[model samples]
Target: MDKPTGSTVSPQEALIYAMVTLSAVDRQMTDRELRKIGDVVNTLPIFGGFDTDRLVAVAEACATITREEDGLHAVLATIATSLPKKLHETAYALAVEVAAADLHVEQEELRFLELLRDVLDVDSLTAAAIERGARARYRTL
Candidate 1:
């Protein structure tokens, strides 16, 4: 998705885009996933300075990018270009978190995670750890 202007996407926005993309990957955005996204933005230190109200707009922008021709590719490209190397893992982690939100990992979501991991260049070990952590956090009784 090409931005009309030359301004870069902020780190926090990049993270949000990743989460939103993952949530919408299955073509169905669940309430649990949406709530997890909101909770993450509200509670994470990385988003401490971000305004919560802007989340809907940012997520809508991401959803728009994902609806264009080759939208998934476009969204991944935007994410890869927007995020710095250091925060790539954070992006993947957030994606994993959102995917795990509903306590059910669908095939589409899993594929999206794989695609995201490759795009973010997250090492296998780190990706495994992130996935494990999300599983642990979302575990049932």
Candidate 2:
């Protein structure tokens, strides 16, 4: 991933990139994680219809977001208010994938997920369920 050069980018794109890159922060961007990211990126209606071009743009934007911001929470907050509830499951699922990618979820990763859930306004129960799913995935791996 490289820094994006676009003069302007959408908040949604930034959030997606933030989430994806953070998932890989533990130094393992697993096939499962990548697939999950791709599914979330393409299947979600956030971009109306995410394409190669959009994916590339979002990837670039995500790189920039990581470099420019301290961490994921700031990026999440930027678009959290407008994010659709339907996608919380996708977001949670993605977070789980990220956490499980390295076979271990760091406290920082957990914190980031917690912040993400908060920012997205996802209920605690849903957040807990997602965390459990991530933990389950790790255990099976």
Backbone collisions counted per model: 0, 0
Task: Give me the candidate number with maximum TM-score.
Answer: 1
Q: What pairs collide in candidate 2?
A: none
The local lDDT score (0 to 100) that residue 137 gets in candidate 2 is 61
> What's the TM-score of every candidate structure?
0.92, 0.65
lDDT for each residue of candidate 2 in 16-132, tens digit (9 for 90 to 100): 654576665555566766666676666666646445456766666566555665644445654454345576566656666666765766776777776666655678887778777
Highest lDDT: give the candidate number: 1
Note the residue pairs that clash in candidate 1. none
Off by over 4 Å in 1: 1-8
Residue 4, model 2: Cα distance from true site in angstroms: 23
TM-score of candidate 1 relative to the true fold: 0.92
How much does each candidate deviate from the true structure in C-alpha RMSD? 3.4, 6.1
The Cα error of candidate 2 at residue 8, in Å, is 10
Global CA lDDT computed for model 1: 0.88
